[model samples]
Target: MGMAVVTLVLAIPLLAALGLVLVPGYRTPARLNIAASAATFLASLTLFVVEPAATKWFVLDAFNIYLIALTAFVGLTTSLFSAGYIAHEIRIGKLKPLQLRFYHAMYQAFLFTMLLALSANNLGVMWVAVEGATLTTVLMVSLYRTAAGIEAAWKYFILCGVGIALALFGTILMYMAAQPVMGPGMAAMTWTELMVRMPEVNPKVLNLAFVFLLIGYGTKVGLAPLHAWLPDAHAEGPTPISAVLSGLLLNVAIYAVLRFKMLLAANGAAIAPGPLMVAMGLGSLLLAGFMLYRRRDIKRFFAYSSIEHMGIITFAFGMGGPLANFAGLLHMAMHSLTKSAIFYAVGHATQIKGTQRMDAIRGLTVSHPALGWGLLAGVVAIAGLPPFGIFMSEFLLVTSTFARQPLLALPLAAGILIAFGALVLRVQQICFGAPDGVSKAVPVAWSLLPLYAHLGLVLVAGVWIPGPLVAWFQTVAALLG
Candidate 1:
């Protein structure tokens, strides 16, 4: 039953992608897209109830189950938000009806690839899935067909393509490392088998493989230095695509890195993966914090925010205690919900204001109070302010860091302060002051639902984390070590 659920979850989006292409008209595909995504999310939820035994090709466990659920849920909500969003785009003539059909189809394809990447037990298969996601997103990023859009798409393809190629080599090295111990066959490449037999694998080879995997997956995670493509892609793509990129795609890439980190942990002689992650995470946090002040485009500003938060999550995981791991997990969930909500609000704001420029979008509260407040709440949550899930997670992370490594906490706190100031500063300018620019009303339907629903959850989480969630996070946190 569990495997059936898994298969169904993976198949729905793939089948929907194909069906969407043949289905005529924008409204039909849009509705079908929401239906299919909701069904997938339902199937993914079943995993939490029915524990599936590890198979030769796939595994259901503490680590991936939550991520699967999160991915599916976000996919569903984003599709809901996209329905209304795409309608606006069409009405404005920014996108044609034909392009809408293609957009809906490619959206499902992107979801399918992300699910495949998350569920695959074979390292090679997971890499292929990630690459597939990259390709599908590249198409979506270029859907506008504008020179800037095309440039962003090409840059995304070239950079991530190179990263994926390096990842492939790393996967090959992992297989070679396992071959002697597990024999030269499929079993050697299976994650379950590799985990069980990792200690016998060559540590030096595992170390080298990890390096390649980190750089490869890290590129997708939008970690600094390797994150050049991320801002442009987010800024140039459709708002819905930007939501998925920041919320789901980056999480999946981090998941891949976490999987490899586990393998390295199992190999007793290998260097600790924690330090490497910490270094990269710190770099991303500091760099993105400083960069955030320079963003004129709202989407790009939030894109940099994504990079900064990803850095914090990475830092938490790198710290490696049960508390830090738990913090990382919580932060991941919070950031996903909060950031996507921010994007949804930002999408509508940009459309209503006739621009993505932060300077042009002013006094949102006065112009469209609901959206203005929605954006305000989202920004506050994302900025790691009090009474939001982000604040809770960050608080735990900082205190945990201070307890274990007092000096390291200094830089971590510095990054947070820097990012918080930038976000608050920009948001103040956009949310307050005199009303400016166009404030035409866009139909508020299921679009705002996602924003409010996500914020409500974040608010609840800040005050109280449910027992089951805490326990699940505890289990996963133990696994990380």
Candidate 2:
């Protein structure tokens, strides 16, 4: 039953993509897209009830089950948001009907690749899936065919392409390390098999492999120095694509890194992966915090916010204690929901106001009360304000760091404050002050349901986490260590 669920989850998107290409017109495909995504999400939810199991090609476990479910949920919600969003674009003549067909098709394809990456048991397959996701999104990022959009797409491709290549080399090294113990074959590349025999694997080879993997996968995670591709892609791409990039793709990359980190931990002789992750995480957090203050494009500003939050989650996981690991997991969930909600609101605001410029978008509350308040709530949640899940997770991370390493806590807190101040300032300017731009009201739709639902979850989780969920996180936290 579990395997069937897995197969169905993977198949829905692939089948939908094929059908979408053949289907004529926008409405049918858009509706079909949402239905397919909803089906996939339902399939993913079943994994929570099933026992952890593995096939020769895939595995289901605590670590990935929640992530898969979250990815599916977000994918479905984003598709709902896209229906209204793309319809608006088509009406305005910004996107042709043919482009809408292509967009729906690629959206399913993108979802397929991400689910494949998360579910794959073979390290090589996971890498291929991540690469496929990059390729699919590169096309989407360039969908506008504007010079700027094309440029962003090319940068995304070149940078991530190079990074994935490095990751491939690292995978080869891992296989070589495992060959001596597990013998040369598919088994040597199997994640489950590798984990069982990791202690006997060559320490030197594993250490070097980890370095490459960290740098390689870290690039995809939008860690600094390798993150040049991220902002441009987010700014240029469709809003739904931006949400997926930040919410799903980055998490998948981090999941890959965490898998490799587990391998290193299994081998006592290998160098500790924590310090490297810590350094990179801190670098991304501090860099993004400062960068946030300078963003003129609203989407780009949120893009930087994604980087900052990714850094925090990375830092928490790098800390490696049970408490820290749990915090990291919670933060990942909160950031994904909150960031995507913000992007949803931003998408509508930009369309209504006919601009992405923050300076031009003022007094949103007066202009569009629902959207303005929605954006405000999203910003507040993302900025780690109280009564939101992000704040709870961030608090856990900060306290954990202070208890374990006082010096590290200083920079962590500083980065959080820096980002917090910048986001609050920008949001206040946009939501308050004199009313400006687009006084005409846009029709409200069910699409906004996702934004509110996400915020609601964040709010509820902050105040009261269910016991079962806490237990699940604790189990995963132990596995992480």
Candidate 3:
């Protein structure tokens, strides 16, 4: 019953999204989107008071409980922002009412897909959920149907499609490995069951599975070499969608990778998943850091930053100790918060400035102080400034790496510094100048709410984490190993 509640909470938005297609009313879709998301938020809130729950189809543990809550919370807030953002787009003639309806429906579907991925007890089900999310996001990405939007969407579809197919094969391989230990049945495929019997599975197959799954999901996570599609998607998609892509989609991809990591850790004979993760993580960090220097579009610039931060989180997790895992978890949460917040500001900036080109945008601080400084704060926070959650989490990760693997720490730290330089240089150009772009007086205060709220929570967590949260993380960390 408890697990059903979690599943149902996630399902409502998706079901409503399907219902949206049948409804002819344009305004109704937006209202339905908001209501469905709000209800999911409230339903997820119930989980905080209830004990953790698990079943064959669903499970709620320390790790995913917080993730579910956070995902739902952000989903609700983003839905609210979408209401206004899409309305503005419709008003400006960029989107027709028919397209607005489609946007609302797709938004709900995306929420459902993430929730499903987070809550599924079966690994196969989780993969299906993530694949569902991929399809939904591709539609949303191409909603505008501009040549650039269509091209971006197609690219996202093809790359992610190939990646997800590999992940499915990996899942099947894991099932094959598990079947010998747990019997040739569905029980062997259950994530909870597999975790319990992990030691009994074949290490060789598990090693192969990890490689396939990592490459598959890592593409979605925007790790380097496989991240070519992300910048274009972000550059061409709606700003609200950009927020969710950076804030939620990438995290879901990482969550899938973590699941595989847990299984590898459980099988004692398998080569430690840590080294491969570390290599890929470091490679992504280094690649994104240098790539940051050449972006001409604002959204693409932050898209690269997404790759960089995802790399940092991946590296932390790859290090795999109490301190490093905790930092990785914290970094994941903080990056989700900080990146989405940056997108909120970026969305508004593009709306006011009429273009995404970095060169066309100048002196935001002179014309729009609220958005300008809000963006500045987000950039500083993401760039690892003190007093922000990102800075604290990153500090822990670096310190832990230095203590454990000093040799690897040099390149990791260098990557961060390079990324910092690129962000600061670009931000200086965007935030301070002679004020050339056309500006609007429209107050997008509501959209700013989620951005600031996330940043505030991150700051609080950095300065003083609650006792319960800390305990929860420790428990999850142990489970992770």
Report the lDDT tens digits of candidate 2 across residue range 318-352. Answer: 99989999999999998999999999999999988
**Candidate 3 residue runs with Cα over 4 Å from true position:** none
Candidate 3 weakest lDDT stretch, 10 residues: 437-446
In candidate 2, where is summed lDDT lowest over 10 consecutive residues?
437-446
Model 1 residue 426 CA deviation in Å: 0.4
Count clashes in each candidate, considering only residues at least 3 apart in sequence or on different chains. Answer: 0, 0, 0
Model 1, residue 11: distance off in Å is 1.1
The number of clashing residue pairs in model 3 is: 0
lDDT-best of 2 and 3: 2
lDDT of 1: 0.92
TM-scores for all predictions: 0.99, 0.99, 0.97
**C-alpha lDDT of all candidate models, in order:** 0.92, 0.93, 0.87
TM-score: model 3 vs. ground truth: 0.97
Using lDDT as the yardstick, the better of models 1 and 3 is 1
lDDT per residue (tens digit) for residues 155-185 in model 1: 9998999999988988999998889888988
